[model samples]
Target: MMNRNFNRRKKFIFFLPVAVLIVAVLGYVVMFLWNWILPEVAHAGKLNYWQALGLLVLCRLLFGNFNKGGGHNGFRERARGMRAKWDSMNEEERAKFKEEYKRRCGGWGHHRNKE
Candidate 1:
């Protein structure tokens, strides 16, 4: 019984390092493939390890959302920002912005008032 327990513990120790190695290797391969297979814009100027990590964090902050069942939330945020800036403008500027936004985005980004 003691021998069996010792063997089990030994196997557990071996398995622990193996599992960690597997994870590390997978991470390395994924990072390598990301750098090798993808373009620069996809990485957001993240060529090295630290750069990739930093860019990942910054990009997540600038545009990180999984909503509306699609990957277009960044565009939504841009639209919202444009709307808020337009609304904060003076009447003349707002009118001009409305025209431009309407021309560019079909007025879906601007708020319309109804009588």
Candidate 2:
């Protein structure tokens, strides 16, 4: 256990600098792009390095995931669960479910012309 902890600490120490460097590079890229393009095209003010870095962090928090193995896994899992439930449903149950869904959601955007 001691050895394992030491190894983990060593790895973290080694990778921390790399991670920081990568984030710094990304921040510089963001700063460069915003300074080069947005000031001219969007009439936006130029961002300094720190502001660009903060913006990068803000965007990540708002719209990005920090997961290492990121993908649509959550959506896929939900879809898989729904598929399993649908497969297990009988025809009558499925029809009833569809009717309930249609009743709740007003069908699939098709409009009926009432004469």
State TM-scores per candidate: 0.36, 0.75
Candidate 2 C-alpha error for residue 67, in Å: 2.7
Enumerate clash totals for all models, in the order shown: 0, 0
| lDDT per residue as tens, model 2, 1-115 | 9999999999999999999998999899999999999999999999999999999878877766656645445887799999999999999999999977766667577764433
| CA lDDT scores, all candidates in order | 0.68, 0.87
lDDT for each residue of candidate 1 in 4-90, tens digit (9 for 90 to 100):
999999999999999767656655665676777776647533266555555545665776632463446567789999888877889
Best by TM-score: 2
Determine which window of 10 residues in candidate 1 has minimal summed lDDT.
64-73
Give candidate 1's whole-model lDDT: 0.68
